[model samples]
Every structure is written in C-alpha cells, then in structure tokens.
Target: MGYQYQLTKVILVIIFWSLNEVIPIAWVFLICGASLPPLDLIISKDKYLAQFPWELYLFYGYAFYGILFQAEQHLIFLGIGYSLSRLVLYFQLKQSLNT
Candidate 1:
C-alpha cells in the first residue's frame, strides 16, 4: 500500500503538472493554497472542500514516516525543500493577488 501510494502521487503530480502547462490556469493555487477559497465561491461549501488536494496529506504522511523511522534519509531533505518551495510559491501568488 505504501509503495502504491507513493507511485500514485508521483504519477498524479506529473499528470497535473503537464495538464497545467497545457491549460495555463492558476489551478495549482486554488488546489494547494494556504488561504481560504475566494469569496465568490463561499456560496458553495462543497466546492471549497473539493478544491482541497488529498495528495498533500499523503505527502505529509510520507515525510512523517520517513523522518520518524529514519529509513529514507533523502526524504527528509526532499520534503523540506519541496515545502519551502511551495511556501515561496504560495506567498508570491498571494502578493501578486493582493496587488
């Protein structure tokens, strides 16, 4: 199950990344942002939840397991790097949106 979960995440990320390149929409922020959904979408509670990506939870799971067990040394640094990168991306988007 663990192996399959990681494989699925890799595949999904690749697929979505490719899709984003083709679609040219800011869908990644809507799906992965730290902030609340846009005020207009407040009318539909379900829509906000639907936009939340479950893959993030899995990513956290992988990081936690890797760090706690110290089974995969690479995962810890990789996870930190990925998280920091995401943080920068999110804030950049937030600043742009605010302006």
Candidate 2:
C-alpha cells in the first residue's frame, strides 16, 4: 500500500507537470496542494484520522477552487484524477483490513 501510494503521487505529479502546457502554474499548485492532505490521511491508521471528513473537504475545496478560478474543465479533470486516487487508496486499505 505504501509503495502504491507513493506511485500514485508520482504519477499524479507527472500528469500535472505534463499539463503545464495547458494549466496555469497556480492551478497546478492549487490542485497538488489540495490533494496531499487526503492522500496522507488515506495511509494513516489513526482512529481520529479515520473519523475525519477529508473526502468532503477535498470535494468542497476543489469546487471552491474551480469556482474561484472559473476553470470548470480543470475542475473536472481534477475530480477524475482525485476520484481514481481515492479508489486506489480505498482498495488498498480494504485489502489490508481484510488480511
């Protein structure tokens, strides 16, 4: 799971960097900054961390960022990537729990 998480982060960085031609540097920074906390939370085993609503925060944060910047397309792309990353984390966590 740790390796997978690291890989996901690396992949996301690559994807975002490649989008530098399209997305502004500020947007790229915002997206990456907004994503790290939730990713960190996903790997934590703390009971308090499990109880926090990071998902809602991530969604709302992205929405707010998009609206503020008036970038719906970037928002949508961020949503898709974010959802896929969360799904990967979810499955990894679930597998670990079941074992």
Candidate 3:
C-alpha cells in the first residue's frame, strides 16, 4: 500500500536535515491538523537520515487523501527545497573556485 511506500521512502532517503529543521517540518504538518509525533522521535545512531517522527503518521489526524498524500506532499516540497539549495551551493562553490 501507499503507507508502506511512504514509510520506506522516509526510512531510506538522505535529505540530511538537522533536528532543528525537522521540528519546523513537523510543526507545519501539525498546523495542518496532523498530530505531532512523540517527543523522543528516534533512537538511531544516525538521526539525520531517520524518519520524521512516526507518531504523526500513527495519529493520522489530517488526511491527505489525494494521490500524493501527506508524507508524499512533504517529501515533494523537501525534494524541491533540497534541489534548489544544492543548486545554489554548487553555483556558489563554483564561483568561489573560479576566483
């Protein structure tokens, strides 16, 4: 099912956002009626690459019932932000390197 896919993607991807970034992302979802996950989100040695708090999904307060759904929507936005930020970083580095 789509739920499995979202969980897998969340577990696998390497967006590399800090814990600080995660709170805002969750807060955004929470504001949209998605409940916040537990305070102790993850127990990973590498929290940077882990899931964005599983409790929110468990609560399922907000329903992104469209084709994309909740986590997927967040993911698309995250991907866009990641790509744009990467592009900026690459360009800035290139310019610095040329100078």
Candidate 4:
C-alpha cells in the first residue's frame, strides 16, 4: 500500500480503537496472543511481565496509543518500541544478508 493509504488506515484503526474504551482489553489479549505487544506494555508495563488474563481489564482503559496515565509517555514508549524493532530488523534482515 502507499504510505499515505497505510497511514490513513492506521489512523482510522487507532481512532476506532480509541473510540470505545469499554472493550475490557480484548484487543490487548488478542495482540499478546499473536506475539505482539499493544502500546500499553511498552510504557507503564513490561511486555514480558504483563499477564494475559489480568492485564486485560487494565489495558481496556488504555487509549489508542496506550495512554494509561499520560498520552505523551505512551507515545514515547511506542516510538521506542518502533525504533528498537527497526534496528533489530535492520541488523537481522539487511545487515545479516551481506555478512
């Protein structure tokens, strides 16, 4: 997909996800189940330490960007996660192939 299209889709999903804060963390559970950490895990909680069942309710309160207490903190953590993953992917995927 084009970058703009992808971004718009992501924005919409984010908006939809944030629209209903009453889901009870169903997405968080599903995300964790799929070996993905939702935005909340990176900020106030550790991904490894989060329990699937119990954190479900708590995660429901999270915003689209996983803002439990502070939105900026959530955004910072999300950027951190993205940067880390990008670095990993760069080293493991691109750099490794040349080595």
Candidate 5:
C-alpha cells in the first residue's frame, strides 16, 4: 500500500509538471497560427505595411516571453517556426506581386 501510494504521487507530480511546461508552448503556437492569416491579408492589402519590420517586433515579443518564462528551448523553437512561416509569406507575396 505504501509503495503504491508513493508511485501514484510521483506519477501525478510528473504529469502536472509536464502540463505546466507544455500548455504555454501550445498556446503560443495556437495563437500564432490563428493570427497569421488575418495579418497576412492585412499586410498584403497594404504594400507599405510589408516594408515595416514586423518580424523584428515578433522576435522581440518572443524574446520577452523567454525572459519572463525562462524557457530557452521553447523560445528557440518558436523563433525557428516563426522565421520559416515568415519566409513562406515573403515568397508568396513576392510571387503575387510579380504576377
């Protein structure tokens, strides 16, 4: 009975800790994904907006989150994902302009 109780407690602690770390990362990705399309539309409609350094602002925001949360790995992954998505958007916009 004692061993079983200890095992259960350990499992619960691990689960909760994992969730605490995961939930924020999941939220970041979810919000970024949801916002991208609308932002892309707005930027596309306004060529001058594309000239703005929006990506730098995003990087600063991500860096702020990292500083606040002390989650270096999450910040690195977020930066990579954001850069790739922005690159894709840039190429798509360039192509559209050419046509």
Candidate 6:
C-alpha cells in the first residue's frame, strides 16, 4: 500500500480504538460507565508533587506535523493551542518544584 493508504488506515484504527469499536460492549463499559468520571479533569488537574509528562505534547506535535505533511491540512489553531498548553504545563511543573 502507498503512504497515504497506510496513514489513512492508521488514523481509522486510532478512531476505532478511541471510540471502542474493537469490542461490541466496550464503549458502554468505558465511556457510558457511570462509575468512571471524566478523564479530562484528571489529566488537566494541577499536581503539587507530580510532574507533567511533556512527552505526550511532543507526540501531539508529531501527529500535527504528520497531518500537515501527509494530508496538506494546516491545523494552525490546534498547533497554537498545543503550544500554549505546553507552556502552561511547563510553568506549572517548574513552580511545583522548590528548586
């Protein structure tokens, strides 16, 4: 298969995995499960002793670049949002450490 074909397949797989198409009843258990709270709150919450993982932002940079390079899609706003979030996380982490 060509690069575009492969990239499309990869994106489709990611979407499917995120949406829980891999298992018939997984979405209900994962997303619609009343026991579990929203994950965004946990991820975005500030921590006093814990350091944020900047590598995830780096992965996002890679994904944004990949989209731009392969699909000719210019997601400048998303890139800017990512950059701002990275800065916020960096400053928050810096302030958390006494050193």
Top lDDT hit: 2
Residue 88's C-alpha lDDT in candidate 3?
A: 47
lDDT of 5 by residue, 18-54 (tens): 6666677654553444334334545354642355436
- How well is each residue in 24-97 modelled by candidate 6, as lDDT tens digits? 54332333322111222233334313556454566477656776786322333334444455556556657766
Clashing pairs in 2: none
- lDDT per residue for candidate 3 within 1-99, as digits (tens), equals 465446544643333333436666643432222111111123222332332334334224333342345455664444344334334444554576579
TM-score of each: 0.40, 0.41, 0.32, 0.35, 0.40, 0.31
Q: For residues 1-99, could you state the per-residue lDDT of candidate 1 as single tens digits?
A: 465445545654665576676653444333323222222133334432333334456668887787687655444444444554555544555576579
lDDT score, residue 59, model 1?
Answer: 61
All models: lDDT?
0.48, 0.62, 0.38, 0.41, 0.56, 0.45
Better of 3 and 6 by lDDT: 6
39-80 per-residue lDDT for model 4 (tens digits): 323332433242234433333444444554556443344344
Clashing pairs in 4: none
Q: Distance from true position, residue 59, model 5, in Å?
A: 5.4
lDDT of 5: 0.56
Model 6, CA-based lDDT: 0.45
Residue lDDT tens for model 2, 22-97: 8785567557645654656645546322443366577767777877887666665566556555556556666777
User: Of the pair 1 and 6, which is ahead by TM-score?
Assistant: 1
Off by over 4 Å in 4: 1-8, 11-71
| Candidate number that wins on TM-score, 2 or 3 | 2
Shift in Å, residue 92, candidate 2: 1.2
Candidate 1 clash pair list: none
Best TM-score goes to which candidate?
2
**Worst 10-residue stretch by lDDT in candidate 1?**
32-41
Question: Cα RMSD (Å) per model?
Answer: 11.3, 7.1, 13.5, 13.2, 15.1, 12.4
